[model samples]
Target: MFDYQIKDNCLSNKNILITGAGDGIGRQAALTYAKLGATVILLGKTVKKLEAVYDEIMALGAPEPAIIPLDLKGATKQNYVDMAATIAEQVGQLDGALLNASMLGELNPFTQIHEQIWQDVMQVNVTSQFLLAQALIPTMLNAKNASLVFTSSGVGNKGRAFWGAYSISKFATEGMMQVIADEYDSSTLRCNAINPGATETKMRASAYPAEDKSKLASPEDIMPLYVYLMSDDSIGETGKTLKAQ
Candidate 1:
């Protein structure tokens, strides 16, 4: 796992947004951030799951959380713009945003990759991120310091034979993070990417069903990096991809 000490109330008075917060690493991150005193905004495709996370955060006696039920696959630029506007109105400012929602599509040979699957992966992993980040930049700038974190994969920079569109989209994700980080080089807002290496999650299971689950790291094991990127500790770090293992 990433070497960082977890601090109490490290994110106090901060408003953090986490997409795909209903499950996997996203879910663990929401719970973890809430426990650390952040006012988390849980955004996911399932309303029930978001509500469940909301209740969990409230149970922790942390700040009350907000929920945004959104499916990235069908989301548009205007939708992201409106969502950012609403966040600005409701939270006043965004301290951090974890763009963790992504589609794996299917792992297939390049020549056998399906067009629709490719488009779907690109839409969820690339286009939605572009739109959301573009819309959220202004609101994020409201804070004294803000972090925009994108999720990348091991295949993100390397071209894997069977990774297909998923790998390609991750490459785009890395590019987008770099572009934003460069544009905001001297600004308060920082952008970065994280590759959660081989964690035990639903996505990992789907990709490798026969693998030994017990040998893999849990979502909680990889949260130190997530918290580090969101907290004030990573103020000057940007445009780099770090791994959590």
Candidate 2:
């Protein structure tokens, strides 16, 4: 895990948005950020799951959370633009956004990869992120200091034999992060990518069903890096692909 001693109310008065906030690492991150005094915007496909997370955050007596149920697979650039506008109108100014939602298509050999599966994976993991980032950038820039964190994978940098589109999308994600980071090199809004190495999540379970999940890290275990990137502690860091292990 990335080592950082998180101070109480580190994210006080901050308005952060987290995609895929209903489950796994996203869910844990929402709770964690809320506990640290951030007003989290929970965006996910499942309304029930988002509500559950909202309840959890409220139970923690943290800032009141807002939920936005969006299916990234079918969401358009216009949808993202409108959503960002809504966020700006309601939240006033955005401080951070975690582009953590992704899809894992069928794992197969290079020659056997399905076109639809490839398209679906790319749509959710790459295109949606691209659109969302484009829409959110202006709002994020409104803050005195902001962070835009993209989720990458272990196969993001290295091409894996059976990872297929998932790997490719992550590679694109890293590239996208680098591009945005470089563009805003001297700006208050910093961009970066995080590769959560082999954590125990549903995506991990589906990818390696036979593996021993007990040996893997939990979502909570890798949260230090997530928190660090969003916090003021990482003010100057940008364009790097960090690993949370």
Candidate 3:
């Protein structure tokens, strides 16, 4: 349970960019990072949602957070490249980046997976993440020690039945993470993946409508691992999947 001290200023001079930060785990992570003294960049498709998150970070009197409204599902390489250039210009070098955005396509048998659903899920969950990481690599490498985390799932590590494109995308995500980690492990850039097991969030509710939510941990409860991974405490760590409480 939060092995680290979680110093009031753990992220004291860092800037962290989090995607899918409008809600769920991403939102919680943003708020936590802000409170811990990092300037947060909130990214999501919905401007209002990102605004709300920005307001929350501001209310805490933490750092002045920035909002980026862009849908990953339809984003292109140029879009990510432009975003990276802007971040480099504004924040200099990004100290941390969490690839928390994802799309849950039709969760059905592979044989029944819709063609559009497969493409859409891969766009957001895999392709977009790749492009974003590619764009931000330079910025991240510029940091003293930067951490890159990809949101992964249990089904990703092992192919499961009826999980369809979502699982496959996560698997790709994990592989992407390893590739980055292996290539940059000796450098300032470290890459890893997180499997926020059974967190209580809207996406989880949607995926498990019949299950009892009370049995799952809240997003807040899982921040310890997230915060740890984002900070210097885990500097030597890379190319592994972390499980959140």
How do all models score by TM-score?
0.99, 0.99, 0.98
Badly placed stretches (over 4 Å) of model 1 are: none
Q: Model 3: which ten-residue window has the lowest total lDDT? A: 1-10
Per-residue accuracy of model 1 over 1-245 as CA lDDT, tens digit each:
89999899999999999999999999999999999989999999999999999898888899999989999999888899999999999889999999999899999999999999999999999999999999999999999999999999999999899998999999999999999999999999999999999999999999999999999999999999999999999999999999986
How much lDDT does each candidate structure score? 0.95, 0.96, 0.92
Residue 147 of model 2 has an lDDT of 98
Clash count list over all predictions:
0, 1, 0
Question: What tens-digit string does per-residue lDDT give for candidate 2 at 71-159?
Answer: 99999888999999999999879999999999999999988999999999999999999999999999999999999999999899999
Model 1 TM-score (2 dp): 0.99
Model 2 misplaced regions, further than 4 Å: none
Q: C-alpha displacement of 75 in model 3, angstroms?
A: 0.8
lDDT of 3 by residue, 19-79 (tens): 9999999999999999999999999999999999988988999989999899998888999
In model 2, the Cα lDDT at residue 245 comes to: 79
Ranking the candidates on lDDT from highest down gives 2, 1, 3
